[model samples]
Target: MFRILFYRPEIPPNTGNTIRLAANTGSQLHLVEPLGFAFEDKHLRRAGLDYHDLAYVRVHPDLDSAWHALLPANVYAFSSHADRCYTDVAYQPGDVLFFGPESAGLPEEIQRLPEITDRLRVPMMPGSRSINLANTTAIALYEAWRQRGFAAGG
Candidate 1:
């Protein structure tokens, strides 16, 4: 499945939801360090998740480490500033669907990166705020899966 990378996420519940998503979708969850919440088991339990749910979750020291480990797959950075719609990308399996923190979004440098294949957005009315992090990830992942006929356990 496509990898989900949270670039220095701040909220606990968002991360918690994504952990469950990765487990169910067969996607790998990557978290960049300087996270807002502790990776304590209680946090997972409080969010209706169990220790087993984190089997697909991996924490990286920083973006560079994540990039090195993830091998810099075709990255689709989700941003409100993007001109391309998320659905336009021809997502392949193992494509990295990268999302920034809930509040700040991705850094300015990411937008211009040579390796980032595309920048995308879920269309909303002008001047509206962004979608929930988990929801965005879900939409992107399903779209990718849909492109591949929803292959499971591949």
Candidate 2:
């Protein structure tokens, strides 16, 4: 399974939806701190709708802590600024898919970090801002899983 990392995510519903996505897709969700809302926020709970228990979510105090936990893996940082399409990558199990906050995408410094194997982007029509955070995560996750034969299935 891929590891989904959200750095300083700013929306409750987005993170909530991702929690559900991770549960259903058998991925781990790692959240870097300075989050916009509490894990116990009612909106978040409502959006997650009892799926939280089924999901594996880790909260890191900072980006450094997250790096300490998730390094030594191929990290693909998602950003609209990237030249490469996400599907172009041959994703392997245990790869890390990283995203940034809803308002601001991943910082330039983080995007250029040595740990990031590459920066990837999803296609969109001209004049579009960007896809929803949860939806983007799902797209990347499913593509990677599909390439792996959706492993361990019946």
Best by TM-score: 2
**Clashes per candidate, residues 3 or more apart or on different chains:** 0, 0
Writing each residue's lDDT as its tens digit, candidate 1 over 98-142 gives 999998898879767876888999888887888898888888888
| Candidate 2 CA-lDDT value | 0.92
Off by over 4 Å in 2: none
User: In terms of lDDT, which candidate is strongest?
Assistant: 2
1-154: candidate 2 lDDT, tens digit per residue: 7899999998999999999988888899999999999988998898888899999999999988998998889999999889999999999988999999999889999999999999999999988888999999999999999999988420
RMSD of 2: 1.5
> What number of backbone clashes does candidate 2 have, counting pairs of residues 3 or more apart or in separate chains?
0
Question: lDDT (CA) for every model shown?
Answer: 0.83, 0.92
Model 1, which residues run further than 4 Å from truth?
Answer: 41-43
